[model samples]
Target: MKNNFFYGYSKQADLPEKKRLLFTEFMKNNVKINQADSATLLTGVLAPPAAMAAKKAGESLPQLKMIKNVPDVLFVPSATVVALITVRFSKRLFMRN
Candidate 1:
């Protein structure tokens, strides 16, 4: 159990059920986003399985709303892919000047 990825969370049986469910739901929804360092700053590192357990326990996790992609020229080479990406860069450029 100690070796589990969510050992700390699993051991948190003393936590209030509502708070625990929220944490778990947060994890389940943001698991992929939290993989990035920047995303971690925004989201957090939570345990998805813990959230699943909460769901199984009859707690409903609210839908997690996360941006589909972060508009960075480095990751998105083509500015045409998303007009927002171009707009974002333009805003930055204008601000810098």
Candidate 2:
């Protein structure tokens, strides 16, 4: 029942044999950031801002100028969704072994 914070497990014996082996294997492996993961992280970080900028640019065109309050109408909810996605992605990205 001991809490081993250093190794991130409560007790080795409490874990099932299969899980214990998997945990040990995971701990033994070297943790390196995957390039694809880095790319996904970068895209997540940049996407919202890039979308906003593009939306603004599109709004500035004469034909597109008829639409007003696009930020309030579109970007607000989209930004919220993007923010939520980024938060979730960041948690996964940072928690990866």
Candidate 3:
């Protein structure tokens, strides 16, 4: 339907079954990454239902690999707690500069 978020993609035909899927797509592929406006840079969003339905219909879609959370994450986070990440570089690398 014209109102569908993926109307244009759905209308495409004669494409390789694998390439016809709508998963991750660039927002502005023609724009150079380094030169394009940061605000209009490429982006993509998930349409899981669409992909799943396509797979059920026997269309060959790119295999989606789902990442399961660490098995060690058995304990649920507290309401007031937030997960944090830290990146540490080698002391030798910074010292050389």
Query: lDDT per residue, candidate 3, 1-97, as tens digits?
Result: 2334356555654565633443234344334565433222211112233333434444333442221221213322221121111011233355579
User: lDDT per residue, candidate 2, 39-60, as tens digits?
Assistant: 5567666767777776777788
- Local distance difference test values of all predictions, in order: 0.45, 0.66, 0.33
TM, every model: 0.26, 0.35, 0.19
Task: Report the error of model 3 at residue 20, Å.
Answer: 6.4
Model 3, 72: alpha-carbon shift in Å?
7.4
* Candidate 2 lDDT trough over 10 residues, lowest sum: 3-12
TM-score of 3: 0.19
Model 1, span 46-71: residue lDDT tens: 32333334334433324522222333
Model 2: residues with Cα > 4 Å off, grouped in runs: 1-36, 76-97
Return whichever of 2 and 3 wins on TM-score: 2
Model 2 clash pairs? none
List all candidate RMSDs to the true structure: 21.2, 11.0, 20.8
lDDT order of candidates, top first = 2, 1, 3
- Find the candidate with the highest TM-score and give its number: 2
> What's the true lDDT of residue 6 in model 2?
43
User: Model 1 clash pairs?
Assistant: none
The pairs that clash in candidate 3 are none
